[model samples]
Target: MSELRFEDVTVRYGTGRRAMKAVDGVSLTVPTGQVVGLVGESGSGKSTLARAAVGLAPIAAGRVLLDGRDVRHRPARGSGRAVQMVFQDPYACLDPRMSVGDSVAEAIPRTGTAARRAEVTRLFGLVGLDAAHISSRPSELSGGQCQRVALARALAARPQIVVADEITSALDVSVQGTVLNLVRDLQQQTRLGMLFISHNLAVVRYVSDIIAVMYLGRIVECGPAHEVLTDPQHPYTRELLAAAPHRDGYAANSAHEESGAVLDTEPPDPHHLPAGCRFHPRCPVGPLALPARTDCLSLDPAVGAVGRRHATACHFAAPLPTPSHQAT
Candidate 1:
């Protein structure tokens, strides 16, 4: 069975006149012992979905299943121990006054004093922290160390799955690598399931077994990490990858330099979303002209079948005629 599953889940905020569905008819299955990357721009409902999966956000419709049981109906309180969250900001997550040891130990309560002490020491070691750092406060540690402490706290409950929401975005590049490696190592050691949410497609490619792309509260594409990254079928997916910073040098007359290309349009406000595909407004290439692209703004764009290990929500899933930005 999948570790966690969202069956046609919908989370609507507000009521009556202003009710808005942050996650609209979204369904996903995260298998055990694998990392699933949820990639999208801000306000794409990634974090909202993450919160609902972990019981932090309430679901307005559909079932949030854990091992095939509805968590919303059953209220998986103790079962939450098996599914924990490592938030994006570690410093804000931790208490300034509490000792790092106390914070980590708070996840799992132990009976005997000796056993508790040993558990704390083991967890510290597990997250690559010095045992001596246990007594220190949050202010005493660097951003990376604090994040490690956060990971240790999440694992303290012996969770089978962790929802990591951009955990490395706040850290420096050097420190981000350490934290990413640590999470990967810890996952290998524990064989834990993970739902990793991020905007960075490069980082998503590195760690995800599967990638799910989101646009305006809907999953626009889903596929294997390498396949989706290397050859994206959706226009939004292709645009995202093209815009991503790469290691390779760009030629003078490149896709990025096209004058009329819609690379700089602002994302639509989530409260007042546009019609048709949420990404249509910002989509660089379309069959017709902008603003009133009748064919492009058709009711139901053709989303390819969930075969070939890739599914894309585009009326035209055809390959791009012109080359996208060069691969770094």
Candidate 2:
């Protein structure tokens, strides 16, 4: 069963005509004992959806289901401890004044002094932090260490699902792999479900069993990580994979970053998203379509399955025999 699910969820910012939907009609599930990776560029609403699950973001429409219950009815004030989040900034989320031991101990249900201490010590070892560092403050620990502490605190509650929003984005490349390995091993041991969000495709592809691609608040493609990365159907997915680092593929994203997007226009205003396929305006081939690109410009495309465990939302989406220009 899906431990966490979003059913046509939409998160809006502002009110009246000024309101804009940051996450629109997003339906996803994080089942038990699996990692679902979400990949998108900045302004793509990846974080918004992640926040909605934990009652941090208001759901403008639709429902967020946590452990088979609607979050709105659950009243996150009490019965909402089933899900925990590890944010992008490891240091910011932590309390500077509180000692790391106390921070983790706070999550333990046991009120006895000795019980809390023992649990904290065990948690420290689980996250690879030393028992000696229990009294350390946030300022005393390194970035990676602080992150491990944050993770320890999250796990102390034994939440069923963990929402990790770019948790490693701020760490050094050397530390990033270590953190990833630690998380993967922990997930296996605990059978914890995860919603991993990041702009880094390499990390996502490695850790995620399934991957979903987002653009401008809409999911454009989703499937098994390896299939989606190596044989993309949607144009945007192809671009994202082509730019993925360490893959034996051409660096198309680098060119896009240096010069400009494939489409030679200003970034679309999120406040006033264009009608039709949200990705069409930026799609290189959509403009040249027959029928005056009416469907491409006016009708939103529904996600259609093209192969096993794969789907794409594009009027022109067609899987290539080999989408990536990788060295054979």
- Candidate 1 accuracy as TM-score: 0.87
Clashes of 2: 0
What is the TM-score of each predicted model, taking all chains together? 0.87, 0.87
Supply the TM-score for candidate 2.
Answer: 0.87
**lDDT: worst 10-residue window of model 1:** 250-259
Q: Please give, for residues 1-328, the per-residue lDDT of candidate 1 as tens digits.
A: 1488888898999988678889988888788888899998888899999999878888888887878777555434443276789999999999999999999877764447688789989999999999999999999999999999999999887776789999999999989878888888887788888899998876676678888998888888887777677667776777677767665331122332322366478888777776666667777665323444565565545344353236576765644345479889
lDDT, candidate 2, 1-328, per-residue tens: 2488888899999988999999998888887789999998889999999999888999988898877798656444423267889999988988999998988888765467887799899999999999999999999999999999999988887787889999999999999999999888888877889999998887888789889999888888888777676666676776677667755552333322322255554548999887887776676556533345577787767545343235688765554345568798
Q: Report the Cα lDDT for candidate 1.
A: 0.78
